[model samples]
Target: SDYSQEPPRHPALLVNSKEPFNAEPHRSALVTSYVTPVEFFYKRNHGPVPIVDDIDKFSVSITGLIENPKELCMKDILRLPKYAVTATLQCAGNRRTAMSKTRKVKGVGWDIAAIGNAIWGGAKLADVLELIGIPKFSYISPCGGKHVEFVSIDKCKEENGGPYKASIPLSQATNPEADILLAYEMNGETLNRDHGYPLRVIVPGVIGARSVKWLDSINIIAKECQGLFTQKDYKMFPPSVNWDNIDWSTRRPQMDFPIQSAICSLDDVNNLKPGKITIKGYAVSGGGRGIERVEVSIDGGKTWVEASKYQKAGVPYISDDESCDKWAWVLFEAEADVPESTEIVAKAVDIAGNVQPENVEVIWNLRGILNTSWHRVHVQIGR
Candidate 1:
């Protein structure tokens, strides 16, 4: 692995791993603005970032179980109708660090920052599929293709040095309402090497792992992708299940993230002058669900207060509304008077009434994915 070829990263990022680089911004950085800047976006990579210097020559091969297999180059894709989508991409292991404290778990040790919201610009994947002879909203092809596999140019040890790949159901891939993008730009600029540069698949509202970057090809398969990251990794397991008894096929890959919220204005432990305090952070749900309410608790979890939520500044957030970006996150804030030392906690509820669990132990898994437990931070007020 040639680490030298990797692109430069933001100096403020807290790097978790150097090779196959993975880093995240501080929790405070996440809530500074509604749309996360590209520089502050978390980087989750499985291998060295592949360099594609020749955009004109680069192309994505669309093949497998298709009537008309076509290799669409940059120009060919750019001709399709363009759409901009503001979506949040969260790693399946976003809160692995918190999960690890309950019990030992595998994978990267990440805090609450393994997530980011960005405005992605690109051609609609449904439009691209239409060019390859698949009509919009088709669930299966005439040749028995049920899944759309996205293969990347980057290689990882997890796949035994094979190119990383993942897949989505054919129904989702062909549904224009899904807002799936073969994204070419991030945050209004051409994607930097850290992100998918020439091309990538943006499977909005799903776990970030399925959005394969630096895309090399698209495959119409009879079944879901059998890649290591798909079949062996990213699946949740019971707390009682260990490597000995773990069955990979028993559980399906995690898709939509659960309801989640966190306190970014304060640290895990903080000392502050006793006075009025403004608590702010991000709240988001998966599968196009909107955050209904964010509750803040200053006296541990015994009592709670509903925090105000919004997506754009000065505009109240309403789920599934035309104005609200259904795939994006909502930022919440609440003011409190802290006269004595107390533990502060925050939990989110989506529009569907799904609330984050109260305890991490109960939802503990071997892989440490989807730890949507209440986020807690302790405060020591005054001397």
Candidate 2:
């Protein structure tokens, strides 16, 4: 089935699926720059892309819990105060391939490159909502609205072949720290169709799935969104639970991702010199948490050396002022002397003290959604 509507993509992308145009670049290409180039920003779509022939006519409805439930066209969006923020967007299943090594898990078998960082520009969702009038940011409004739901124009089987929708707690939606945006631009230009042109919501510090593409409508309601995506798909399960025994309701929807780091320098079967070897990778934590440091171990997890890390755009492999909020990821590198056959393991610790688990068995689940365990790579000692 021809599920995609966008034009041709870069040939270098390691395509995961063509129906929805899901693809990613190699880990080396992904970390080439602090703000990943938009062309290689790792497209992740669940359904057929909508054909928006008229960019100006693309309008989104803002209904529910508002004084004016009206339709907003592109003009309406650009008229608002625009702001740009540099952040990383990562799929919940970014490292599913690693999890599958331990046990079979269902979902896209993504490699380390399923994530990308970029500078996004748009009108703040809060400002857009205020135009229609929020009145108050109470825990629960008098009208019984406690959540803000985002609906996408794309239809998928996950919602029984209907529209894709999800929500965030109203408190979080209205929080200034949340930095939610109705984004229209990536880098310095308009967004590409594959990356949600015209308008799309950017739920910073959350999984990429929650940032629904192809603008449609939004609603403020009581209770969480009941869309299949919010209710069934992104929830995490314990390692003991299989599909047959899964109690979907018992688990909470994943909001912020866990501490994750990976070794992107050397690949399996790749030849490396016998002397001092250098390893490079990226590390990121969810919910605006900063990475304390990344540790690399040449002889497995027995001993570790802190990797040099820098979190800034415009300069690659160079450390910036360490005071910036951790909205983006930290690109890091570490060196160790190599001997015979060996494996290198890397893990990151977040500001909140969360460290990557040693392996997937401790966090494995049927879906294999969040596979943020220690990342290991094997290399051959060569001449």
Candidate 3:
């Protein structure tokens, strides 16, 4: 059975791009409950999945501006102490559909499903860098001047480039709070080929594109990655900018997702025998600032109500100690008296005073990113 060809069985999935790659997820999966299982998690890929047969032979190379360029085999990397984190990976284009609604955009028409939460286990990037004599503070000092570039093992001969590569600012790469990982395992098992086998980079709090798959090499530099993924694509621009007038260099690569949230439930229009309808969803902010609160609005953003709150997803250690962890998502819920109306709308706010926009038009960009507007659902009210 080629599991790769199988379609996802989740009922709530909203399909976006489909081909050698498919991006989708249960719209309400994030807040319907905590702990999104590996199977139900969203999948995003830039190319066909590569098949790897030998884990022992696989190795990762660290090069560029480092004092000692080192190549470590998978077996050696496993010898070090391992840590686990429950982090969410969201594609920069997660809500492309919301942008398309306003005007035509240029890439995969992703819905909210391009995001997923996972419990990743691997050696901390800082610990590894320390072994190679890379100073922890060097990332922060502008004088040291280093950028960490991630190169995927997956390769293809493209008309314009060699393979997909992405980079993050050195400060983000070395932050202990970032919890960056040379991940060999996902959801407790070895990574699937589509997910990057042998090794991959898991960069928490950044867009998914930066977390390159099929890990091969890490290079330190004084400038941002010039690859297509980092420079020519995955950026945000004013909604007024069109394809003909786009100035790629004027835009910066996206990092640190903005404060965002969505509604996960609605009244069953067909069976409208409801006393009350409950709203549930997840809210999160990037750059390690935990979600402070989630507020729900029933009538488009005119009136607001507070939702019940809980810890972010994939946090297994939260049960043991809460203080050690500072970031993730906050699940929320609110119940509203269902009026005999045609539709219900919901929006949420995060800790940093950032609230979802009232409508998509106000925040819509040409690339279809940062679509954190109110999510609406239509339902009939009858017995």
Candidate 4:
């Protein structure tokens, strides 16, 4: 309800909505680098950003179904271990604008830029849980803790103006390899207000909703958080399911995102001089899967050419590399000769062999989430 607390954002960002601020960078800016700058990173907020001016007084309460409930302050967290991770976060509605063209869908309209990669610095949740006597990989204990719910400080209408909240399986929360973090920094700098300031949860390889911002409290619960975003929204529904016949219970909350890619070098429609053209984009998959291959087609989908993929500059991306940032995205590029007007399309295959669907119509849902359909751009060749 308070608009004065929101922080200033970059002027280049394409503002999708004013209230509950949601905006993203231009598609071309996304592929300029592997690690997205904080200023260019997509912003997705449910409500007005909460302000936490006093770092000393900020604390996150660990409660619910636990024998040793503890309140961790900034000093307590900093005393433990610190780790930095490079990960990408993509909203479920990243390509909602394109999806809505097929049929009207609910939620904010977003272009293809609602995704970004950044290096997050913070304490591991597993290590933090250990301080409370919860061992690694522990799921349901005698106290009945099966899910780890994260509650944010910001209030949103979705939860009846309650704090935005979500949860993850306790198993994932306790797994050190999962790389979940109670993050306090982004892109090597203290997190800005636009992002979760002071602290926030970072659940790598999952949908962005689970990464609650504006650190509030953590709850070890027996079931998933019954927040509106978790229970009613973000769940994938078939095209057949409409508002009148919708059954939220039929589907579970979406976690990992599907394989996705988009041609960022060009807009949805462009006019260019006929000659050698360079195409660039980004590709990523969920659950820590690496991108195996990225293909580009200039003549629609009839013929395709393998595009080069890389995560770091001058370093070719190898999906199985031990040092590779599995949770981040790879930029793909290729060169093609164009003498006539044609449609350009890009698709990717992950290490697990997951490929983007060819069309958006089949995957269309009421919420227009996870539109990982093949990305296409129509280019007019000019003399």
User: Which candidate number maximizes lDDT?
Assistant: 4
User: How good is model 3 by TM-score?
Assistant: 0.89
Better of 3 and 4 by TM-score: 4
**Model 4 C-alpha lDDT per residue in residues 264-371, reported as the tens digit of each score:** 999999999999999999999999999989999999989999999998899999999987898999999999999999999999999889999999999999999999
Runs of candidate 3 exceeding 4 Å displacement? 1-15, 140-144, 156-161, 267-271, 312-325
The runs of at least 3 residues in candidate 1 whose Cα sits more than 4 Å from the true structure, single-residue gaps closed, are 140-145
Q: Give per-residue CA lDDT, model 2, range 1-383, as digits (tens).
A: 24535666889998988776789988788667778898788988888777778877789898886667989888888898888988889999999988998899998879998888888899888787777777434355533357889998877767777887888887777665578888889998888888887678888779988888887998987778888888888888888899888878887778888888887776645677688887888898899888888999888788998888876553443223455645788888887888876888999988889999897899998898989989988877877
Task: Output candidate 1 Cα RMSD.
Answer: 1.7
- Can you give the TM-score per candidate against the true fold? 0.98, 0.94, 0.89, 0.98
lDDT (Cα atoms) of all candidates against the true structure: 0.92, 0.81, 0.71, 0.93
Q: Please provide, for model 1 over 210-304, each residue's C-alpha lDDT reduced to its tens digit, 9 standing for 90 to 100.
A: 99999999999888899998899999888999989999998887878888888889889999999989899999999999888999999998899
How many steric clashes between backbone atoms does each model show? 0, 0, 1, 0
Error of 2 at 212 (Å): 0.7
- Candidate 4 local Cα displacement, residue 57, angstroms: 0.3
List model 3 lDDT by residue over 1-383, tens digit each. 12254333455555454444665765655665565666667777665566667777778898988778999898778987887877777888877776787787777777666777777788878777777777664556653356889887665433142557888878767776678988888889877666677788888877788888888888887888988888777787877787889899987888888877766654223346546877776666676666655666656556777777666444422212455244456666778876775456666555566767777888777778778777766666676
lDDT of 1: 0.92
**Stretches of model 4 off by over 4 angstroms after superposition:** 140-145
Error of 2 at 10 (Å): 0.6
